[model samples]
Target chain A: MKLLFSNEVKEHRFSLKCIPHDTDMQKIENIDVSVFPDNITGKDIDSHGNITIFGYTKELHDSFGFDVEGTASTGLKDFESAKELHMVGMYKYQTKITAPGESVLDFSKKHSLESCSSNEEKALLIMQNLNNEFEYRQGCTDMDTKAEEALKGGCGVCQDFAHIMLSLCRLESIPCRYVTGMMIGEGRSHAWVEAWDDNRWIGFDPTNGKVVNDEYIKISNGRDFRDCLVNQGIFTGNVTQSQTISVIVNEEQNLIHD
Target chain B: MISYMDICGKRDRVEDMEIYTGADVVNEQLARYGVKFGIYKNNEFKEQLFPFDMIPRVIDNKEFAYLEKGLKQRVKALNLFIADIYGEKKIIKDKIVPEEFIYAGSGYLPQCEGIVPSKGVYSHISGIDLVQSKDGTWYILEDNLRIPSGASYPMIVRGIERRSAPSLFTGKHIEDNRNYADMLRHTMDYVNCGGHTVILTPGRYNAAYFEHSYLAEKTGAHLVSGHELIVENDHLYFIDYSGRKERVGAVYRRISDEYLDPMSFNEESVIGIPHIFDIYRKGNVALINAPGNGVADDKGIYYFVPKMIKYYLGEEPILNNAPTYLPYYDEDMKYVLDNFDNLVLKDVAEAGGYGVVFGNKMSKEEKEKFIAMLKAEPRRFIAQEVIDFIDIDIMEKGQLLPRKADLRAFVLMAEEPMVWKSGLTRFSRNPDSFIVNSSQGGGFKDTWVLSQ
Candidate 1:
């Protein structure tokens, strides 16, 4: 299956670096990008399994934009054979992004999620539980909001849903990470999770209550929401600018669906 | 066998004691030179002088020889631990150390995974604290791998003491500690890939700002702030006061990992360069102590260092850690509960003499409350047997009194692990206090390693 994923990122008073990285399930077919203002050379793969794009810059005064489009073929994975094998950097996913008074294990016990079940079954159950737990209200929480807070408030965006699910999965010792990517149909950008099973990584989007398919393309993954940021800005400008992201996912076969 | 030699100071104990009679005069000179610690509590800044003692803690040449060897071996094992945790993780896989102990702590940073420094050196400078018990056994306290400071205090005070007491210096033989600056420069230069070396400071407001600036001047490296450094084209460039830019090859960054890059770690950090971490990841520049070393020195991870020495180097530990027990294990938790009143409980997350509780001193009601909290969060605490460490004499009201002291030995990992011939011996001011931290009313004495 072929999928096209692209996003347009703009910088205002602060400059942004739009990173191009590789993911597990899909391999990139072709990368089309235009970096304006400046570009730096050299790169390496970090311990987190992310390919670092080094020395790309957008200076102050004018807004520089990056239009990145990539085509990839989704491949089949045998997640069953991956278990009982030691994975380097697995400690990265086991970390809990703690918020004040956020006891994920206590919440799990409250929901009786400690039953003897397979890791995937537990992950799917968590996704289903969180769909009912959250009201799917946008603007209810910001990017820095923790899952424990969102669960208590009863409303959050996809980012919060992913965090809540990540906390629950880590409590069960199931390795999980946060992923920012493009989903099929209509949306600006999507936040979801990828759980490490025996032999492969499986994606679960609790906000939509479904497993991600070939139509989804992962941009980057990290232990928490702080790591998967597509565009990061650091500048000394005194101006406050409101920013927006534009994303479009196109499937190769234009199949009409009900 | 003593690998190196030191010169013995000819003066006896009484003559050395006579030289310290003018300690008050030397202390007043310290205030004039602005040798102070700028402390910030409740968001308010206050400056206080880090008082110095004239009496030196003298160590024989043979004793220094043993300490130097152990310091090298311990730092070597620690560096290997950092490398393994980031890359192979064989220790975790073999079940030599529990994964929960390594990953559960706040110091373990996942962002630092896979970033090997220029020379595979994670801790360029390791400040290993050691305490001598009353029976004369040296016990390891804790390792300060990430920017272990206080090296500058002795480096600066020596100049003042040399000028103030010329008569005292002529009669005694002492190892010159002024070569520390040269050692530091060599360590930084050893890993340089070609460009200039710069000391990147968080700014004057940071606690270790004095050391940062002092070291920059002494080593002849450019002293730069975060604002003065920029990441462009995957290279770190230092901008001069005239606004000219030059590529930086090695950077001794004097800031925490969380505050090093706004793009990588803390998004709200205004004092960090945005893409500097990316530059480091590309291997274009070298970070002094490397990021993600906190996991190795964490109070929780300290329990497994002796095990790391065996796993990484296959050697018995030269130095012994103070008898410690972690509550994370069921057996240790049981021992801690059974001997609650006899042990000193320490919160793993706290440092600088904070979060330490004497179980014997707690009231029964307070003890019950603490035990409940300890049971509720077992990983957050560790229990240790209090060692009655020996004391050095200090002049309190012109009368000599014994107070607990601890030595912080500076180990530089450059051309092999080079332990400084001398160390910073800090003594507590309060008679009963065991904590000899400079932050907790502790004054420092120069450690003299005899050449005899």
Candidate 2:
């Protein structure tokens, strides 16, 4: 059976409502987006039989960052599967200039654009740099991450990789977008990336330089990974967070009859 | 001849008494011990409740002796075939079994090539399923050489059944079936590294979790998961609750070959103890059923078991095999394609009762699709004639009903290949259902081979 793929990119404008409104007006400076689109190829279709499109933004909007509230819509398509679907992606909004004298642009510049290269190369360099620069320590970053802070700590997972790469892409003026997609590599998990080069955004595995192939199936996209959040809703009480992602790709043969 | 009345009177003397004319009661008692097996569905654990019947199918001593000889001969031949496939490829040269069938089988593991196992025994535990017809004859149904389960259930059930019907035991001099634990222990001891025996389980949530723990407890072996095992310096070691390290003797691992070694078979396996295959390869530890034994268990390879028995044992097969058709053969492929609706199609690579399509159960379009699939990848599929064995009564909805069932009798090959006197008798719950696999909503009964 041919697994249905119904994701097409169309123009969209989205808005967001930040919780617990920040009263300090001086902390707000700039707002920017780093998302883009890419064309699908025959090779992008997986051998185990599934269509995967993983495109994301790699830009950081720092200076003049406002206590952002509103929606941003883009020309993108929604994902659906007739049988079952395994989707993983993230949409994030990085709050810039949390304190006085810390300009949003400086914070963004300090985190973004340290290296300018192809997505694959950049991902490789980032992994080598992370391995050389930081100690392999866990519990360093949470959902609320600052690229500047993570750069100082020198250790993070794919989320941190996406955040740091987004900041850099934004500094470079690349129309990078944050993408949430299912990674059918050795294991299944959500990964983030910045798309640039005429919306033909390629994925950068900052943890490793493993290029996103047909195995990486896109779920959703936005400015950052937090924007394309899979399960994000405020609960009534103190919630200890726990998450699990399982993706099964089976080899399906479709005998096309004339 | 002792009639049903005599059996009922004997069963009445026991508590929680239920007199079954056949083997189904044994399966019921096994279910009480929580001895069930499991299979994977979409990467989730699903337990299999093998349906069993109460009526005990009596095989006279003379017939059983012949069957015992044939089963041992068949298992020995299979072990030799595995050795040859991994070592010499002599059978292929002799033109007995085709070479492509061995290589094309998904169960054929290239990693096991040239690596000899301890004691040269590839299939230590074999669960060979057999069925008997109403005319009083038995035929081999299937062979499960890789980590076969259900022995513990019968071993435990016999204890309960004997206690429940003590008089039944007094009249029959049935061979004691409790020696399976001792047999398994000795098999492990033959390949031990001077440490304690461990039953390696995937986890508590696995479908065979109950059996893994049950077997471990019954055999005086520690139940350890993949996380509890560590390999250092090409030697296997187990981590204890007291934070101590002890060398592991034998691991009757219930996990598949791919998930047993992350570094070897599948790099993404989190449930596997990384670097453990290296220890097995180095002969520092023994893997029960042994990795790569799947080469023999492949359903496609099953067509040659009788031939294999003849080749290695230099003897004719005592037990008869159901007529099986391998699509890989040109004539067989043509036959299967022509008779798509008459034969049952099975994917040789799939087990736990998945990817089986009965021709009678499908629509015309579905049959066409299967035909196309067979033509496209003939090696991946096999066709078999549906066996219409005798059905026995099972309790359901407060009444007895006849259900299709089969028996998986465990044969332990430590000192010598010995069949467990008790077997797992599984039956289908649905009256119309022909597939009695426990994973497909079946229940089990304890099998009693009556000693006349």
Candidate 3:
């Protein structure tokens, strides 16, 4: 059966009041942002399925306001009367693919299935079977939803599908990871999955049975969707602010001409 | 006459215990065994040199016997109190302790109501702090019913001390203090669910990680993290390296109650085992120092322990209190407000040596602010008269000096409450400091209760 892979659709908006503390305001220079890329395909990445070249940041890498920055004063301070800042972003993408024509039990039977059978191969088989059986549906699951729940539901967004696949892979002893990025296609935003096959990592679009190609751009990789959300913040101001997001995805056709 | 002052001088008068002091010293003993404890400051992990004084505190047999009875009685009453608070609320209903005082206290959890522990005991291990007055009267300082630490320190330090002070042991027959591991193993077995026991830690960065690892090594329990445990079909299991799963009999978890189960307590807790509470509720596993025990350890509830002893055991308290005043009571509130400068005001909600404001240390503005807070939230605070306890000499910058010290004695309650022969004796590093908390720059010494 042909498997349908759906991209994660994240419509998120937030406002942060950056209060000028005696310490933090002077340290604040410029805000760096890494928006999920647009216009990408499934064939460009390695087997482990990692694409690190997608998310872009203008600010110095040290000032990215995350744990890598190691700044004590990174988050918005608890201050009064500060005009709270707001940011909004959204994601959407889809791929059509065919599942590998082998059940996990059948695949294991062909393999040694001995006492020395590697956990990694077992995990790959499980992942392959899960992708083959489940249909990707948006808004059917959330970020906190576990893989077992997603599998039981049989339909969920890219985040849920990836998490379910990753968890099953992990259960089989393979180190699987979640990837957040943009696919160059006729879509608003996108996300996908990466798995470690043997010593090498590989990326495949379960939604559209295709290897990730150079057309794909990568943003961040984590255990789940909660780790790679584009933007996260904390603010103290009482008044809430509204946010809106817009994205345009198109393939760069004239690569040699440019 | 070898006065106590002379013995103190013999220990603290030298640059190091091995060179100057005439005591039989085991040099670099803890370093040899890789025995160390960890503490956290400003979110940074630091290893602390486990302070050991060659001069151990000696309590006569009679004094120890009396202390054992009082400690056992106190722990039993506390366990009963916790069971009652979580199940029947009988203590509150009988007006022995105020219901508002309990509900308003942050430690009380309504979610834990009607949930019974495996052995009907709330505090499997209790660390109760006490101090000796100049007149030799013992006073109860506080109770640590939830995740009490430092038992392994005493257990490990005694091994080193026994090797060094062979003469000290010959004169005074001290009972074997090595049965802590056996006691702990038996305690876990008492509540076993037909599986292996494990010590759940929040990982190596936690302040009590050393204790967790040490106790797990000593008691033959697996030291595991949150990622190691899984819940399925309302049963808790540990996933081994070979992918073989084993049911967990008991879990002596070092993490706080709130961080034990993400689904039941704090949803945002990443270090918690998800859905493990359901397994514990289903009687598939036992959680040592079970959840909702904080309600019994509340500082407000501490004031009524003597009363609880009378109410539950119909016996008088052997140890006295240091004149604690609960602000929730009208007359006590008035008394504390009138004499705010002479007492120590402590927030009932805070623990581990925080939220304590000494009346004498507060400035005028601070006192006023505290008074305003007292008026705003009366039940949240308590005041106590500072007891002048006897000072002991400790080594400081290679000098013999006197400093305030206190003892945190462990009371084990399994089938019954049993006090260990030895306890942890902690002293303030500063000469003028009265707070001997490890968080507040204190050092610990070996306690030896001599047997007759």
Candidate 4:
């Protein structure tokens, strides 16, 4: 199956703000993206893994809107890992899960997870633990909610789930990374984890508590949600702005890779 | 003792003693020259003049040469360590430095992975602080690999101080500190991809805002704020006052790593360019003293720097670290616990002389509380031997008094590591205080390296 991922992000500011423009929403290489209302010219992939699309008109604005669409070729291949991993794979993703610091370490010890034994087993165990531990309550956690906060409350969205999973996996020395992508399902934006193992990277969805397949379209990857943030912006004003973002990933049957 | 008066001789010293005697006039001139520092203390923001002592701390030619070699070697090993940390874990895997110190460290950033700077140089400008003991052995006090300030202080002040009393410098052959700006320009250019160089400053409210602006003026690079810069087509562009955008190939950004890009870091930072990090990630621009260098300078990691020098360069370290012990190790913790009153404790996360505490000065209750904190979080603190360091003479109230001082040497890493001949030798004004940071009640002396 092929897929079409789309989003329309509208930011409404009550006051006239100095429009230091922002182009944070990325276009992944696996997907071809198109923008609506035109004139949003600059589009470039950033350092880690994300495309930065700019709408650069620095004049003060009351409201700004962007319409984006990405059509990608999708197929569910065998669950085999990549052949060769780079030297950076060894310890790069072994980041300190500082948010839920000691608890994550305790959780790993409690589970008796040894990553050297099996990345598949440890990743699945971590995902299951996260899914069981927390309830997917949307309004219960905000963007500022850390892993420990969410873990303590036993509630959060996909970002919290991914973060908690990252914490546990890293504590196990699994070399896990945070990933922001679309899974061709009914949801806003999504977050997951990719654990490096046996010289390859494999995706795991702690939010839904399952192994990721070709239905998943990767946009960006980093150590945590903070590193792979989808969109961020600021302007000159004492007034706060409201953000309205809608992301849709629909199946497209005809757009298969030739 | 080794003093400037010895090099100039009593005749030249008395003739140029006008420069030392006319301190009030030089300070007034410094105030007019906009040599100010912004410090926030007790919730109050105050901009005050960074007090300059007319009396210069002079190091003879032979001593400076040794310091230069040690500084260059130390920075080289640190750079290699950074590269190795980001690339292969050969050092960590080999157990030269424990893995916990690297991953568990607050300084380490996973976001810096896979990033090999244009020349494999992570810490392009390292500010290594050293202090001489009574026995004449200089030990490195701290390694500041991140956006190290105070270079411009010595660079600008030496010129102003020399002009204040030309007769003082007429007979003495003091190595010119003017080349710092040129060295900065060269370092920026050495890493430049294709476009022009720009100095990215947070604003005038920062502690070293004067240094930021002064360096920009001296280096002839555009001084830009987060607002003036924009990320477009995977490259950084600085918008001029006339609204014309010029491509920026290299940025000597003064902004902290956490506040450099709102899209990539602290989301609420209005002072950061939204996706400028994106430009850096794509190799469109070079960031001076590349981000994620804190891991190399982490207080805990400082213990293993000598080991890194041996591991990376296959050479014995010329410089010695101040006999320091991290509370993380069982043996070191025991040593710290036993010798509680003799050592000075430093919190790894805190900077600017805020988190330092003398063990001998702590009251019983305070000591107990500190011990509890240390036991609870061993990685957070490190203990060091308090060197009864040699005091330098500073003219205070027309009388020369001994004051504790430390030298901050600027090492710029371009093709090869170059140690600036002169350094910013800051001294504590208070008799009992060991902290010599500008934020603390301290003054600075112009460090003069003798030509002969």
Chain A vs. true chain A, TM-score per model, equals 0.79, 0.47, 0.49, 0.75
Tens digits of per-residue lDDT for model 3, A116-140: 3554445445555556777877788
**Model 2: per-residue lDDT, tens digit, B1-452?**
12222444434332333443224455566667666667777998776555444444344456667668878878878888888877767777688887656655667765576678888878889999887765656778789998887777667766866776565566565667777788777777776656777999888788778878877877889999887987654567888999799998688889999898754566567788765765676677888888988889888888889998889888888888877888878999888877777788888888867888898899888878878888888988878877777776655534556777677877777757777666778777778876767777877765555465
Q: Relative to the unseen true structure, what is the C-alpha lDDT of residue A193 in candidate 1, on a scale of 0 to 100?
A: 86
**CA shift of B69, model 1, Å:** 1.2
Give the runs in model 1 whose Cα sits over 4 Å from its true position.
A1-24, A35-47, A51-64, A75-107, A110-117, A238-240, A254-258, B1-17
Residues A1-258, model 1: lDDT tens digits: 111113323222122223435454566667776544446354556555555544443433335445667776553332212333355335234444534245555667767665747767888888988787678998888877887887778898889888888888877778877878777655577889877776667789899898876667677677776666655555444544455677776667533334
**lDDT per residue as tens, model 1, B142-261:** 899988898888887777778887665675667889999999999999988679999989887877777888899999999988888877767888888898999999989998899988
Best by TM-score: 1
For every prediction, compared with the true complex, DockQ reads 0.39, 0.01, 0.01, 0.19
> Tens digits of per-residue lDDT for model 4 on A1-258?
111123222321111111111112211233333333233535554434355565443454545555445465544342424323334343344433335566566666677664536887878888887787778988888887777667777788888888888777766666777877777766567888888787567788988988887567666676776555554454453454566656677876633444
For model 3, the stretches where C-alpha displacement exceeds 4 angstroms are A1-258, B1-27, B32-34
TM agreement with the true structure for every prediction:
0.90, 0.60, 0.63, 0.85
Model 4 TM-score is 0.85
- Best candidate, DockQ: 1
- DockQ measured for candidate 4: 0.19
Ranking by lDDT: 1, 4, 3, 2
Q: What TM-score does chain B of candidate 1 reach?
A: 0.95
Worst 10 residues of 4 chain B by lDDT: B10-19
